[model samples]
Target chain A: MSKTLAIGPFNDAERAALSDEFSPVFLAKPDELAGLTDDQRAAATAVAYKGHHAFGAAQMDLLPNVGIVANFGVGYDAIDVHAAAARSIKVTNTPDVLNDDVADLAVAMLLMQCREMEQASAWARSGNWKSKGEYRLNRKASGGTVGIVGLGRIGREIADRLAAFKMDIHYFARSEKTTPGWQYHGDPVSLARAVDFLVIALVGGKDTENFVSAEVIEALGPRGVVVNISRGSTVDEAALLDALENGKIAGAGLDVFLNEPAIDDRFYKLDNVVIQPHQGSGTVETRAAMAKLQRDNIAAHHAGKALLTPVN
Target chain B: MSKTLAIGPFNDAERAALSDEFSPVFLAKPDELAGLTDDQRAAATAVAYKGHHAFGAAQMDLLPNVGIVANFGVGYDAIDVHAAAARSIKVTNTPDVLNDDVADLAVAMLLMQCREMEQASAWARSGNWKSKGEYRLNRKASGGTVGIVGLGRIGREIADRLAAFKMDIHYFARSEKTTPGWQYHGDPVSLARAVDFLVIALVGGKDTENFVSAEVIEALGPRGVVVNISRGSTVDEAALLDALENGKIAGAGLDVFLNEPAIDDRFYKLDNVVIQPHQGSGTVETRAAMAKLQRDNIAAHHAGKALLTPVN
Candidate 1:
């Protein structure tokens, strides 16, 4: 008879935390709201949501009393905000807490790509270093021109770190930001044209679907590298694969790919690219912090206090 | 017979540059100097030196007329400066040019080790991401306490980059440097005790051999990671391997290892390590810059203009 409906796969610690604080009814997915007993649905005033599954108007209808949907991740792209807004439902997302981890992974992937560290590590492990005399020299990554496709929290964190590496930062956002010395491009194509490394940090969903178009990828010339830490929808994956295969661009460092996990098989053959499982915010410390923040927002909602990180 | 003798393997461009300017005779190694004719030895005034082979009194005695040893790398430990000084032969090393590349690699290895990017990438590329759900969580590297074993030019560059990642900087140097706010430890073991990540940046030579001793490695504890971008002589490789094997320490990112190229086979079995082929300054741009500096130093010595980057 609790007022919270916790959805998605919560780990043991998180499940315990939610039960201890809210006495919440836990379900594996957002669709489970329909199966909840009428009293359970009616009693659920706050939904502690996790996973990347769509939470739309149909699901929201089941939780008639759910005033807020507290999401586990920073990006609320999977949650249809318009549907929630129409239902007079508030949304809370765990932002800022995972920025460092996301930014760190972005830089890590870029470094891995530029250094060809994967091959180098393998060469060492296979005792090829003894047989091969010396490894062939690679292109330098530090002090190069890098373009950030979005100027949001995680993107800004990435730019700050790369700035210390002496990189010339160029960026593309809807409008110019106040960051001193960082050049602003009106369009992403222009941003791509201006740099050797192009990093996509755009928000997920429709507006940004194929935001890094084929044209933009084309602009990032043969010496260019694309590092994506954003959702797969932001980049033209087919075009990117073609470019990587045909040497249209130098390489890519991709963390997020379209239908990823089931990622393009072509990526497996390329030595130029560095593939990472969409692990931008996947760190022990950061994940724990994100979970805590999600719970704290749910706690705030239950206590009739302002949500810790409110969205719509 | 040319008065300028170039020892070790010089690449095509370096060879061309040496031939175009100095018309130097070439030898593959320092040991081959004994094969030179008396006239060739007596006429040779400058030695364009490369490789890590010891160029001691034995090597110098063969070239009695040699006035200077123009070394290709930043570290002159291979060229006994004390012996060179006694023989009235000046020693010049290529320094500062490769600092950025080396520092970049150190940070790259540290990031790769912390994020487990190698395994993560393998998971994604091997189609395990589709089958295995999410990659396992890893520790955060950014904002952690990192101890630099030496605060030289390359060490400072590494510290500056990591500082932007909000890392707490600590170091061990011969004497406390003028860097404000960066915690400095007077001894290696104390520095090892202070931080989670320990990066060795000490100069190579007898003075710094085993600088990162067994005691220092032991002090680093279980959660600690050892990153060595310096010479293998600086670290006790046996202890490091034992710690890595036994989980006495967390992991390692080793660029240089004892008898590298022919590095220990024990390292190949460790998944917790990032094994690089001693490619710190092994980038196209950095290698070119280093080669130019080496030739410039040679040119300066011949011009009787103070050797461009003199060691003795």
Candidate 2:
């Protein structure tokens, strides 16, 4: 077996662990792979991948012996699975490990938004509560209607947590699920129309690009809050921003966004929105689990065993 | 029958509803009662009270015919229940109605604190995610050990919601109840020692003041978070602030403080602490429910019926 290439800027501990197991060559970016000598390229048979940097055929071609790409996150959108499959290369992603963290974040954002906790916290943090009297009463989050855009694993987890708060769970999926007491709407618009919160948990790909459209956003109306823990591509960012700017919708709690790290400047100006740095799975415990799963798949590939969570 | 007095700064709708049913004399402060004529004071048979100002026997004596003191909130520590009982005055408080909102806030605050949502939100808002890399990984909130200081109505609600997240629930109450699967500790220190999060849901009063003392705070150890949604008096605020400041404990999610609105300024300096303006039940729906319940109790007192949620 050839040596492994560890890509992306992992923490010191993760990097040390990767080096200890695989005796890997480290590269922060895929583009740097081209700079490696022919011997180094030939030695790279597997890659431990992290970050949102695109890993396509070009990068794979640089490592001629690369047989497997193990991604650190549940979503492998940045990795070209089709390209990997065509090159007889295996692809594996760490899933299920991050479901709890993402689900917790989704629930936290929804409750924080609906309850106006951000402002309430700020009011208390400042001396305003003493001078301004009690914080203004906001909406009750519990026992309200919540419509999930997709009822996949992560979505199901989100719904499960929300259900504990006595919320009415509505979901939009291609096929109805067997979850009792949960309402299933045929389309996104109908789902949006039926709920006070629209939480997006759809998988990321070309097919899901702008899955939550203008019509769906409009259907959610003024009382609705849009919470997105899935890819920003799943939502029509322009439409969502316009609605929020004009008071067409109540607010949003967004983690992922289009062109993130440099998301739309307008979002910062809106007090109704709560912005998170695409950190749904950015927890020490969850990241450790994801890293472990990624390493396990890489170890399996090296051992000539079946991949634990293969995508391609 | 004498008239009912609607005291405190009520919203227009609440005032209108109170006036529509009972001939209510509105007073923004208890001191304002002295301005009323002797006949006006004599005509007051019931009081719909709000605000944190002390309502002792002195204020109660102002209304010689006052039959019932209906408090708008669950905690009636501000009202002298002993004085009410001594004067044969019926006292009622609105409980259970606000449990859902308060519990929702407790969960929200805990998740928010453990997730480092305050810094995460600021990073995204300031466009730092683009300038900087991924936000540093924070602690996982779900599936962690949580110790409840009191297993009262609100504490039980908090525990119930946390159970949905698959947390290990341990509780400190006077006596262990018949709750299956949840571990019960006889004391606060032992409970704090075993859990990653210490959530205070004990009732506020002299008996429970500083219920979570320095010893309990120390027992929680590092990596432990303290979430208080009950009242300011339940926990030793000085000890909590010291623990947070000195990094003795991890963090805290406080909805109540020792002197809220004017709480210890030291708390404002800590990045790990999440503060709220005593907004455990400050939701429009829950507050409306509480107000309605208060009115109902006052109405019951006038009709010679039993008080709905009598405290004295």
Ten contiguous residues with the weakest lDDT in model 1 chain A? A257-266
Among all windows of ten consecutive residues in candidate 1 chain B, which has the lowest summed lDDT?
Answer: B124-133
Per-residue CA lDDT of candidate 2, range A17-102, in tens? 88778878888988888888999899888999988889998998887788999998999999999999999999999999999999
For this target, which candidate reaches the highest DockQ against the unseen true structure?
2
lDDT value for candidate 2? 0.91
Tell me the tens digit of each residue's lDDT in model 1 across B1-312: 787999987888889988999999999998888888999999998999999888999888888888999999998888999999999999999889899889989998999899999999877776688987788889899989999999999999999999998999999999999985999899989998989999999899999999899999999999999999999999998999999999999999989988868988889899999999988998889888998988888888778788788887
**In order, what are the TM-scores of chain A for the candidates?**
0.97, 0.98
Q: Candidate 2, residue B210: CA error in Å?
A: 1.0
The 0-to-1 C-alpha lDDT of every candidate, in the order given, reads 0.90, 0.91
Off by more than 4 A, model 2: none
For residue B218, model 2's alpha carbon misses the true position, in angstroms, by 1.2
Q: Estimate each model's TM-score.
A: 0.97, 0.98
Error of 2 at A239 (Å): 0.9
